[model samples]
Target chain A: MDLPGIVHRAGGALLGTLQHVRIPGVGQASVTDDPATSARRWRAVTVLRDQAAVGTPEAPPPPLDRFGDRIEVRLTAAPADRGTELAARFRGTPSEAEIGELRAALREAKQLLEVGEVLRVDPQPHGQRKPTPQGAALEGMTEQAPKEGVL
Target chain B: MKAATWTGVNEVSVEDVPEPTILNDHDVILKIRQSVTCGSDLHLIGGYIPFMRAGDVIGHEFLGEVVEVGKEVRDRKVGDRVVVAPFAACGSCWYCKQELYSLCDNGNANPGITEGLWGQGVGGCFGYSHAMGGYAGSHAELMRVPYADVGTFVVPEGVSDTRALFASDAASTGWMGADLAGTEPGDVVAVWGAGGVGQMAARAAMLLGAEQVVVIDRVPERLTQVRTHVGAEAVDYTTTDVVAELRERTGGRGPDVCIEAVGMEAHAPGTPGIYDQVKQQLRLQTDRPTAVREAITACRKGGTVFTLGVFAAMVDKFPLGAAMNKGLTLRGAQVHAQRYIPELLRRMEADELVTEHLATHVMPLGEAPEGYRMFKEKDDGCVRAVFLP
Candidate 1:
């Protein structure tokens, strides 16, 4: 790979590692669940709407429902006045890419249900992008941001 | 179209860039009227944030005219002069409903980056880094504002563009610190750092009925502005002991409310300052908490210490013990501008809050490189450099 490409991948990998590393006395709040356990864990988003509006597990919103048979969804009332807790998990162990897709989907579903549109940041105005490795790494980090958080 | 961008650390450049367009249904395209250099921008420019990319547009506090509004935008329309909230928050979120718009869950598009850094992602900011959602900033001829109906407030007809410009971030952020810290009438309030936000916080405290408001700073020009413009007493921290001064001025009780407007890059005069600078340079800590520590120490027992400043990740040598033992209410948040902008505009319209003095230097967008330099160095007594895009 070219230098920028290598740096870019490293940036994304760095983000992935950040979520699992636990150094005592620092930012040590990351969850270090094993891959299998993580795959089975239900990722949820609290949407500010009624549970009925969020639909049932078998008939969840667009992005969450798109997971279909591969995932088992759950919808419950979030603590008083907060809204509905929409959650889902893969029935079987899934690849890292699939988990990332679910993360992005959950976020999108929340935005769609609340704001009626997913917030877009790309195709926006910017200055020249010099092919510096640091800039490329930030690009890679942002590109992986949607899929790499604790959620 | 032209925009000023972060070319590199401590480097800003003006170059041809694409004009922003409506991306979301609630978005609006703005013709930026006035964008100012904030003290927080200095941290990003100095690379303390470490999230800014080269060529990324870099500004947040601004005033603009709505040139185009998305289909779903109801309150704002084309030709409306508005001051945008620094953080883009969706009004429907639980956080927004609770008047904590800065913590809106739906605002940040790039969540994982900040989530990994801070454990939870906050809202996105315009022209802030990619970690803040990579939104193009207002330091351009044209820019995009998301969730316009919630984030953009119409400028009162009686308020000048210069006066309304700061209501976007500085004034709102300062007001949040004072109002949220529970500043009460007859309370003695002490604020650290007399920058734009610090000055505004002092003014807000006075407006909220603080009996005696004192602003602490080492900068002579800023201190002068504090006494002359803000009508608050000023302390030169370089000469006076901040903790001792606060206690002495408050009749041995210290201040009821202490607000820190100086962020991670706080300046100190002695060994503590040098130690923090060296530690931050070596990456032992992400922020220098000089002002925060002083605030905690200077606050009265059971008093409130509010951090209006921004801190990245972690800080070494924090005075958690003092804060805990003193029964202090320690709190901090990014600007909940949406919650305060409307009232701030009303105050501005009434000429009760004047911010035109904050614009120490006004220049065109193309002069942003020089403007940032002057503002960063505090050269020519520059408090804020307002850019006319």
Candidate 2:
């Protein structure tokens, strides 16, 4: 559908506004609109890793070393909210290629469903047992036979 | 200088005293060439442990040569080197049968045991007052030990008497605290207090496979010792907000286990001894001193809190409801000295654990008063003070 113009514009504008600039302080960051619920949701992650800061001349931050392995991220959204933003956190633990692949997979899943159609995103496809109801709607649901109990 | 006695508060002396002979067929007369004062000994002199009086021998944890043994005691010899686990058990009661000998059921095991001492008909202890179980301690040149066969462990070769002494009480208590806290690899463990027992618990946690151990202490020297030797991180609870610090360290989930090594004297005069009700108190709030509280507050959901310290004689209340609410299991116990000695000694023999590092000062038995003062004030990195009688 030769829509490079629209896709690049959306990606570029979002990237420019979000790059490297952190809020003065983020209070109560929620993975979902209601973080109280344990379901899939769109997530916000912050860049906390700074390999350059360790053993450097700075006095070290009070909340220091929360970089790299200690980097923080949270997920939000649910099958009831629609599967459009399922496993947004899956990108945080992957390489560049893996993240691109995950993004493409989410896009494909979104497209496979009708606009506003419901879908269940298995938050941890690799985890053993049960698909999270995510934001799936019963109608227009692409129910694949669950693979023999996450085995 | 062959015998020890309490002359006054913070005063002790060695005098020409009668030597001990086996009274029971199960008894052993140990010629104590070495002995030591514990922090609890201060309780006896200051009258804090309650019901202690003049002529009471001082010290509880020590190692020595077995000078004589009765006909019923078969395992030990006159010359055999042994480390004593001062707590005794009846070995047949429900608690003892389950290998929980420290909680043994005996006629004297009851609260009314002020008739004489603890464990007289049930189980007994060493070096504590008549309220505890009127048994003489090892901090003397001569001492009589009832139930000697069950309480003393033979020191294996190459494990010096210097090192084996702690297998009696401090080291075992620490190991049991870590064990009760359910330590596992990759878990974060926080121990409150850096006393002899606290540091030992930290070391035991490391040996049992905890990935990180955070030892909380106001005493700088003791904390430094723990950080340098046991690989445990340190927390100066005096200035730092301990609760916030622990939460920050543990992925906001809290430590996997928290051990209370501070027992009663976590704060000053009002609180005393180890805690039995900390099992209940831990349910209320997690805090620094009453490590049981901190353990409850600091543990991850579905974690374990072990109280190894002895609480004073008040039926204090704790948060049993919180423990249940948080889905936590809290265990209360005194050290099972009868059982853990051999296993602990093997670790020492293999050089896998060096408990002697805990012994920071040593003096002749006459200076036990000085030893008592140093340990009570916690001077000179005073984790342990050994008395060579």
Enumerate the candidates' DockQ scores in order: 0.78, 0.00
In model 2, the runs with Cα more than 4 Å from the true position are A1-151, B7-11, B106-111, B114-122, B268-289, B315-317
User: What is the per-residue lDDT of model 1 for residues B1-389, given as tens digits with 9 covering 90 to 100?
Assistant: 98999989889999999888778899999899999999999888999888888888889999999999999999887999999999999999899999999899999999998888778888999888888888888899998999999999989788999999999999999999999999999999999989999999999999999999999998899999999999999999899998998888888999999999999999999999999999999999889999999999999999999999999888998898999999999999999999999999999998889999999999999999999999989999999999998
Model 2, span B47-132: residue lDDT tens: 54543444556667888888888777877889878888766554433455556656543201112222111112234466665444
- Full-model lDDT for every candidate: 0.92, 0.59
lDDT of each residue in A58-150, candidate 2, tens digit only: 322222222333222332332342212222323134443333333333333232222111112111001011122211210001111110000
Per-candidate iRMS values, in order, are 1.2, 35.2
Residue A110, candidate 2: alpha-carbon lDDT: 30
Best by TM-score: 1
- Highest-scoring model, DockQ: 1
Candidate 1: the clashing residue pairs are none
When only the first chain is scored, the TM-scores of the models are 0.94, 0.23
